[model samples]
Each structure stands twice: as C-alpha cells, then as structure tokens.
Target: MSSPCFPPLEPPALSPETPVPQGPVAPPLPLPSDLSSLAFPLPASSPQAPIPPPPPLPPPPPVGGLAPPHVFGLEKSQLLKEALEKAGPVPGSRDDVKRLLTLQKDRFRSDLWWILFCADLPSLLQEGPQCGLVALWMAGTLLAPPSGIPLERLVQMAMDRGYTAQGEMFSVADMGKLAQEALGCQAELLCGGLGGPNRERVLRHLVSGHPLLIPYDEDFNHEPCKKKGYKAHWAVSTGVLLGTQAVPSLGYSEDPELPGLFHPVPGTPRRPPPPPEEGSPGAVYLLCKQGKSWHYQLWDYDQVQDSNLQLTEFSPERAADGRAYVVPEGGVRAGLCGQALLLSPKDSGR
Candidate 1:
C-alpha cells in the first residue's frame, strides 16, 4: 500500500503581519483561501499595573434629634411609639388601669344579668317597695356596696320583701342559696382585680356559711332572739354551721360524748388532741339514736371501734316496780352505764 496522503504544510515564519511578495500586486479583500494561509500572532501585554489604594469610608452621621427616616419600617416606628405611650404614667400604671376597667366591666355585666333575672319574676312578686329594696341589697352584696348603704338596711329590705320569716321559722336554706348566688356575682366582679389572697378571702366569706353580718346588742342578755321569744334564730344557726364547715377545727369535736357528729355544739371551741401512736386507744364515744334504743358508739380515729358501747333498751319489767334496776357488771365504767340510762328518758322510766 502507498503511504497515506497528507495536506501541504505552511512554513512557521509565514504570518499575517508579513506580506507576500508579488510584482505590482493590486490589493484585494481577504479570501477564505488567503485567510486560511495566514496565521495571526498574539499581542504582547504590559505587566499588571499596581492596584490603587481603596477610597476612605465617609464618617457616621451626627447624633440624632429624630431617628433617621425609613431605616426601620413605618409600622415598627408606630409600634415603638405605642409602647412608649403605654409605658407612660397616669393615676395608676397601665396594668392597674386595666384591672380597674375589667372590674367595672364585670360589675356592669353582672348587674345587667341580675336585673334581667329579677325582671322575669312574676309581677305580683316583683311589685312594691320591697322589690326595689331587694335589688339595691343585691347590688351592694354582689358588687361593691354603694356609699352609705348599711347591711342592716339590706336585712330590713330582705324582711320587707317576704324573703325573711315564713311563719315562726326563718327560711334559712333559701337565704343560703341566695347568698351563694350573690357570692358568685362578687367573685366574677372582683377576680383578677384584687390581690390573689385577698380576693380568695372575700370569696370564702361570701360563699361559705360564715356570717358576713354580725348582730350587735346594747344589752347582751336581751338580744333580738330573746326579745322575739323564738327558740333559736335559723340565721344564727345556719351561719354558725357554715362557719364550722369552713374551719374544720372550729366545727368538729372528737369528744367521746359527740364523736362523728358534724357541727356539734355551736360556738364551742374545739380542742383537738396531739397525734397518737398507731395502737393507742384514741377512741371517742358518740351518742347515737338507733331505732327505739339509744346507743353510745366508740370510734377509733375515723373508724368505728364499737357500735354499741352501751345499749339502752326499754324493759317494762324494770319499770313495773318503780325501782331502778341494778346495772350489770361490765367492761366499761358505771358512769357510762348511767350515761346510757340518762340518754333515753323512756328507758329510764322502764
């Protein structure tokens, strides 16, 4: 085989800057063939000039009168202004003002609801001066009392409104329900407006069976109950009972004579024992009526130790001769036996 054919190579010394020699040659536009024959040399570059020093930064603007405009958004500036305004002082701080306003709003709402409730009462029941008086008393008790409104006046108003005594007995249960409702209103009005503990105290006094109003007597012996010739005022009993429940220590007694009984002996100060050891005789006896027989029960702390410490049973045989029967020899004291006897008047005759 013949050697592979190749294109003719141009000499390296021939370049575009070097013109080809031709006698009296006329100039012509470069043709594709002529361009392909020419080779262009790369231009020589000067050494890179030294980088110039950076220009100095301008000084910060002068300290402010008003802040620079639009640096922060318009909304942000407005927010800051609002914050400053809120932080500014009045008679009270913003929080205090807010609390007072909340209290007022609550009071107004409660008053509106109460008025609406009372308005729904039958016309005959709602009519007369007593109704207006009740409304005023309700306002004073539930909201903050208006200036110069006395508790006695409110009591009198309640009396006038047929809310007081029915026959010889005072309707204490009804009054208690009313008191509870009034306390609820007060709680709504005062919550968050007063200090937490004080608010709680107010709530406790109002809702619980403690007497908010105490009767005063010029002569202690000749009080209203005595003068009225009533057995014991229901209000006094209710208030005492309620107060006892609230203060468990004040209300209950562990005395053997009154064990496991609630609200025993009104106004009697309670004396609780020191905590006892596990197996010690921390028993209390309670006078309880079981069917026709009266029994003295013994309790150990919370549990019943003896259901029948002394059983009081009536026997016509003992009563037939009109002589006291000799008490049987027993585990407990003779005085306890006598106590059992004393408990049942019918048994004593027997």
Candidate 2:
C-alpha cells in the first residue's frame, strides 16, 4: 500500500497543461476624439408624456365710460356732458330763447344802425308796418331838409292852411310869383319864357342869388369849384319853393322847358310834417308812388343835421348801398319818431 501512495503524490509534476481560472475582460469599445464624448446610458422614458402651450395675454380696457389705466382721474364722457350742460341750450333750440332773454336782461344792446344792418328787414316789415314807416320816416328826416320848413313856423303854417290841403293847395302860382318878385326878375322870364334881355335879366338875378349858377369864362383857366372860379347862373326848385344861388347844388336835372332851372324836386316827397329836430338823429320815410306801386325807405345822415341822406330800406327790394332799416313786424309802436337830420357828404367832405 505504501509503495502505491508515493507514486500518486508525484504523478503530475506541475506543467502548462493544467487548467487556469480567468477574470472577465470588458468588450472592446469605440474611442472618441474628445474626453467630453464619453456617454452614460440612461433609463427609457414613458411614451405617453404630454407637452404644454404658452400662457395667453390680457385684453385692453374699455373706453369713455370706464376709467382707463392712462386716465387716473375722472371719466372723459362725464366731464364732457357736464361742460355741455353748463353751456346752456344748443343754438336754434327752444332753450336758445332763454339765452337771448338772459342776454337782453344783461343789457347787451347794440347801435341802432348796426342792429338794422344785421336784422332781417323782410321779416320786420311783415311783422310791423308802423315800425317800417317809422324807420323810413327817420331815414328821410335825417337825409332831407327840415320837412319843408323850420319846425317852429311850419306847424303854425300847416294849421292855418288846414291839414286837409292836398295837391298844390298853397297857391303854387303865387309861390312862383313870390320867388320871381324876391329875385327881382320878371314873372315871364322866371317862369322860363323867350330868350334875349328877359332871359339875361333872369340869369343875372339867379347868379346873384346862387353864385354857383353863374357862367364861368373859359379864359379864366380856373377850376369850376375854385374860390374865384366862375359859375353858371341857374334856378333850382326846392319842392315848395324856387332857389336862385351860386352855391353848389345836388339832385339837379335839365328840362327843355327850363334850361338852367331845376323844375322837378329830385328826391322830395309831397307831404306835411312832423319836422325832425335840427342837428338831431332822424330818418326819412319816403312813400313814393310810381303808377300804383308804393316804395318806402329809411335814410341816415352822414354829417351833422343836413339834407344829405342815404336810402336804407324798401319794400319788395333792397337798397343799392347795402344798407337796410326795417322794423320788426308788429314791433313798432306809436309816439316814436323816425326821421333824422343828415349832413351832406360834400358838406362833411367824407
């Protein structure tokens, strides 16, 4: 037994043919160019995970009624309403009457001429005839002579002659005769008769009275209106009377029957007075009849009390001078004077 055990112990001398145990060797990996390229594996995520959208912006604030961010104080609409109310009723509305009344009560008045100029004359005429008449009368008085004669004596004469006198009642022939006698000219010549000595005599008398009527010598070489200028001798009819003078005159015309004498009153109205005060504000009311048509007007003075007047109104027509004077319809009352004394533009040199 001893011999067999010894041989088993030395049986296999250690040799390369013995099996050897080995540790695991990792699988060959691909190398990257940079150190940051190293990657670690991550766990897989769920397929059902959802993404969210961005939040929405707020809306702009309301206007007018609601106070906006920019407007830190009162609402604009309310302020506007308050302002309009303070301004009172709108123009052309019923409330406008109240505004006018208030203005009148406050004494907001204007000049007479300005008022008439701005007024609607047609409306006024339709509303008040007497007012229209008064305005017309005032205009005439202002522009014309003192209603034919001086106030102090005219009333007495009118009363004595009877208020009912009509159509040359005051002896037109006698008046003509008086003029000739006063002028020291024969009646025939003054009345415009044959030529020669009678005409010369009449001419001389007229020159003496009105120096403006004297004929000027061409050799004088002076202006017709110069201080020493010669004038043509002539007679002028002033409605109720005849005037012979050398002073400049207006409203003159020529008629074959009377060469140098003015036969017809240019702008005169044949009527009795209510004379306007001399040097006072007044007007003339002309009631002229062309056939059956009646024309009325108002006039004003450009200077001090004088016979130079301008038309301011007419029925169914307007004045050429852009002036108008009309009374509110039914607004004119009695006892109010209309006529005014007007100065001649020549006299005023305006």
Candidate 3:
C-alpha cells in the first residue's frame, strides 16, 4: 500500500493564462510588521488607526544584497541556469527565461538594500498592508535613482489622502495617484479584473521597461479572490514568467514510514505545475512581491475572478506544518484581486 500524496493543484488554479477571491471567518490577523489597520478586518478604533513608522533605510551600499541571487541578473541567460539552480527542479525554456529576464533590474544599490524580495530593505517589511508599497518602491526605483521616501510615510500619505479604505488600497486609480505623489511616477491602469481585454497588454507595457502594481489573492489556489468584506492585496510585478520550469516544483521523497513510497514536500507545487509551455502562453506567471515574505514570487496570472473558483486544503502554508499563509479548508481559493497598474517615470512617459 502507498501513502496518499499531496493532492494536485486544481485545474482552475493551473490555467491562469496570465492574469491573476473569497471569504473567511478566521480570527483577526496579527499585526506583523505594521500590518495593523492596513489589511483585512479593519482595525477596531476608527478615524484611521495610527500606523507605526518603519525604521529608516540605510545609506547606499557597495555591492548587491542577495548572494544566492534571488532575481534575474543584469546579464542575460535564456536557460535561467542560476535561478534554476536554486529555484529549480522545474526548468524554463531559453525563450521563456529570456523573456522573463527582460523584467528584472538593479533597483537598490547602497546599504539600503540589494534586490527586492530575497535581499530587501528590512524597513520596508515592517509596515501595514504595505506589500504594494514595497513593490511600488522597488518598481519606482527600477532602472532609476532610489527615492528617499520611507514606506511608512507613503502609507501614511495614502491614508491621509483617503486612497485606502476597508483596510486595503483597492483602487488602481487611487494607487496611481499615490505613485505620482510618492515616487513622482505615472501609473496607468492596464487591466481591471484578471482576464480582462488588456491581459496581454501588460506584456507590452513590461517589455518597454516598466512594471505593474497588481493585486492578488494571498491564496495559492488563485481564483475567485473577492469576498464579502474586503479586496485582498496589492504587490508589485517585476515581470512575467513564461512557463519556466526553473520554478520549484513538487519535491518527493520516499516515505520513511512506508518504505518504497513517496510523499510530496508540504508546500511545493502540486502535480509538477503544467510544465513550461513551448510558446509561453497558457503558462505565463507574474514575478511578484505580495509583501508577505522576504522574497519575490512567481505566481500564476492567467487566472480569473469569476465564480468558477475551487477551494483546497493544499495551501503554501501547509509547507510549514500549518505555520504559514494558512486558511480554512475550502477557503484557499480567495484573495486573487484581478486588477493591475503600470507605473512609469513621470518624466519618461513610457
């Protein structure tokens, strides 16, 4: 007899073609890194709860931050050998890797930070519902000079201008306004709701050397992100993943308890993620930062926000023995907000 394996990623979750829901009765979220009044379940006291200010960013440093190199380097590689080495077992084709590489840049230099995600400015991580703010900070600075504004101040600014409501900054229009105010950039709303007509338009925008601040459900299931009370989250999209097999996949080991059998690594991809597509279509993933952790992520954008959602117990949180982004059974399909905003240098007009 064989031990049951971690189940497959739902079909709905798998086919997000390149775009990117629901409820919960879970206890209120903890105030991790200034999350109070910044995310779901709006803070108890009103008149805009006071947010904690983040620590100051260090002066510019000498070398890059991440050693393992969490992001694509300035030099190019079609096979993604480095990322594949660490973020591998799943490999991307040369074309897909090349296409994805076009999105990364040397955003941070000095002591302040290195790459966004893996080696990041610690101060940016200590704010409330600031996932997008970090993404925005990184996006604004990409291929340009770093802005001195602290993420805490930006959050406060957003708060003061009423860009935030119901514990989240849900409007792309509002985010664009804040981007102009904080980073001196112009943000264009590319698409609203995943699978909208402009889904592929995002690709054109990115290739021009700009990034989109997109919203996503924190759920691994990736669909039907809308719930009754709140719109979930906003993260920055560095680029799109075109079915790169270099992404980590389900790692299996023979069950120690049941000899000759196997069990999947708790949180790795289930069903080996529909392999990199030959043309990079049905498998385009967005390289993003959801602001939940220290590194950027490759998430499926080809998903939609309609009712065809599927729920699963197979959340990334399961990897930590339920110590991570866990949600109740059948509730894992929520959190995929389907909108995006493209931020460009206000001066460049790209």
Candidate 4:
C-alpha cells in the first residue's frame, strides 16, 4: 500500500517585536509552475487604546441660601426616629418640639425638588389659610406613628393627594385626607355652632386627651362680636381651662343709652380679651388661630375676631367677666363652616 501523503506545512506567524529563533531551514516545497507570485497576508495591528471616560459633572449650587442639597430617601426615617427618641417621655420639651417642628422647614431647604414636589403652591393663604395646616401638621408630629413617618413624606403625600389646595382653598376635607395619610387612619370631624350645645362636648373631648380644632374668635379689640356679630374662626385646642358651674351674668346698667348691653367701668378703654373667669365656660389652647406672626403668610382664623352666635339664657349677651367669650361654635344655623378633626383611624370595613 502506498504511504499516506502529507500536506505541505507553513510556519506559525510571529509578532514583529518577537525575535525569530535560529534553526535549520527546510527546503521550500515545489509550487506548481502555473501558481506563480502568490501573495502573503499582513499581520494585524494591536487594538487601539481604550477611550477615556468623560469627566464628572460639577455639583449644583445651593438655593435660597439653604444648607447643602440632600437626596430624599429612607435616611429621613432615621432622622424621624432620632427626633422622637430625643423627645423622650414628654413630647413638649422645647428643643425636641423645635426640632420636630423645624423638620419640615429643614427638609424644604435641603431638598431641591421640595418646592416642585409641593406642587409649587403660590401661597398657603391664597389657597386655604394655614391655621388648619399648621394645626394638622402639629398634631401629626405629636401623634407620629411608631414607624416614624417623616414630615417631608407627609407634605409630599399631601401634595400628591391634592390635599394642598391647588386651584382651590384648603378645607376640612383636605385636612381629613392629610391626617389619614400621616396617621394611616381617617380623622373624625366635629361640626356645631359656636357657643352652641356642642360646646360642652368639645370641652369633654379636650379633657379626654383628644385635641380639638375649634374656631377662634380674635377679640384683641375687646369688642363682643355677639353684640356686633362676626364669623367664627378656626383654632386647634390643645388644652381646656374649666370654668365654674355658674358663669356670672353681666348686670343691666341704668344708662338709657345702653339699655340691653351691660356697661363696664365708665371710661374704660378698649382692651384685649381677658382670660376666662372662674365661672366662665372654659378657654381652649387655640393654636395656629390667633398668632400674629408672619411665618408662611397664612391668615389665621382669628382675623375674623368674633362669633355671631352667643350663649345666653335669654337674648345674646356678653359675659360679665369683661373677656370676649367664644365657644366651640356648632349648629346648622351659625357655626364654623369646617368640621373639628379628630386624628382617628379610618374604618377599614368601609
């Protein structure tokens, strides 16, 4: 049998930098006379160096002269926890209170998207007064859940839920939604006339550790609105001062000029309403209603300065204590337009 014929072998290609090894050369194989001038392939070049990455971008400048910008995230949860833990048992410590209260402002300053996330509200007063918002925000902080919802998240949720009063005025309904979002429960709303039958019930609620949102009548001028008549405003009742069972009545003066109304000391100048007397029904710690500060340009309900409805045995009359009398006004006839909100969980069954 003929031996197996072998194909001609070519030497392995080497890079130009690699030195060729000295060795005995083999005779070149004979090529067909017809295949003359055969060309050889060139070596491949090294891969081009990798392209460099672009330089990082510079950070954006801070706005409104606020603190450095912060990325919103779960880190806020730690902050909430720290604030609550700092409060300890009593939540009213000045520092703790201030810290919790300022969280909203601090977050607002730190977050670049806060203004936009807040829906760019033109003015808190322009939509609905912030008395209710402040009251609600305060309550939310005090009643913060064990899970620790941040004030920033609360405002964001409020904005998303359309509870921040875009295009319309903020109302009790909006407050309910806000409370529901923050507390994970819908709040209870109380409605009645100022100095109406519900006044006692409101006082009872405040006594039972339930904060009430009552209408505040600003009487800094010392004028009794019942005598002139005015609207009942909104305020949050943090505490209640109980008066004696019997509130002293203003006695009729002999002056013919003022037959119906009782007259105080002659020539007494107009003064701010005095604190409730022993027998007075009671006074509530009305927050966000009467403060004259200009924090957010929100007009407090106290601007109304009076309640048209009055509590009296006979006709509407002022009390003898010389203080402007206001009550949890509620009734179909004349009371606050909004409802008193109670931070309670909503009914899951519904």
Q: All candidates: CA RMSD in angstroms?
A: 42.4, 50.0, 26.4, 30.9
Those runs of model 2 whose alpha carbons end farther than 4 Å from true positions after fitting are 1-152, 155-164, 167-170, 176-196, 211-350
Kindly provide the TM-score of model 2 when superposed on the true structure, using C-alpha atoms. 0.16
**lDDT tens readout by residue for model 2, 71-160:** 111243566445444643222211222233244333222221111111111101111112212222222232334442222232233234
Considering lDDT, which of the candidate structures 1 and 3 is the better prediction for this target? Answer: 3
Residue ranges of candidate 3 with Cα displaced over 4 Å: 1-123, 165-167, 191-196, 220-231, 243-281, 304-338
Candidate number of the best TM-score = 3
* C-alpha lDDT (0 to 100) for residue 98 of candidate 4: 31
CA lDDT of every candidate? 0.25, 0.23, 0.45, 0.35
What is the per-residue lDDT of model 4 for residues 1-350, given as tens digits with 9 covering 90 to 100?
11012121121222169998999999999875754353532223425334556899898664433222121332546764464345333212222223422553432222111000000011111112334454554455335554455445555565566544321112444555556656655355554433343444444444333445443433544222442223233444443322222222432122233222122233444321233332332122222322222121112122212342331221143335343322323321332342355553233221
Residue 280 in candidate 4, Cα distance off native in Å: 4.8
lDDT of 2 at 239: 15
Candidate 3: clashing residue pairs, number: 29
Summed over model 4, clashes come to: 10
Provide the TM-score for each candidate, comma-separated: 0.17, 0.16, 0.45, 0.36
Task: Write the candidate numbers in order of decreasing TM-score.
Answer: 3, 4, 1, 2
Residues forming the 10-long window of minimal summed lDDT in candidate 4? 114-123
Residue-by-residue lDDT tens digits, candidate 1, 1-350: 11012121111221168997778867996656554354643223424334556899998765432222111122446664464355332221112222432444432222111100000000011111122223223233223323424434445544444444311112222233233333222111111111223223322332232222111110232122211111121111011111121224554433343222233344666542222223333221111111111111111211211211222232344347464322324311221211100000111221
With candidate 2 superimposed using the best TM-score fit, by how many Å does residue 27's alpha carbon deviate from the native?
A: 99
Candidate 4 residue 244 Cα shift, in angstroms, is 2.7
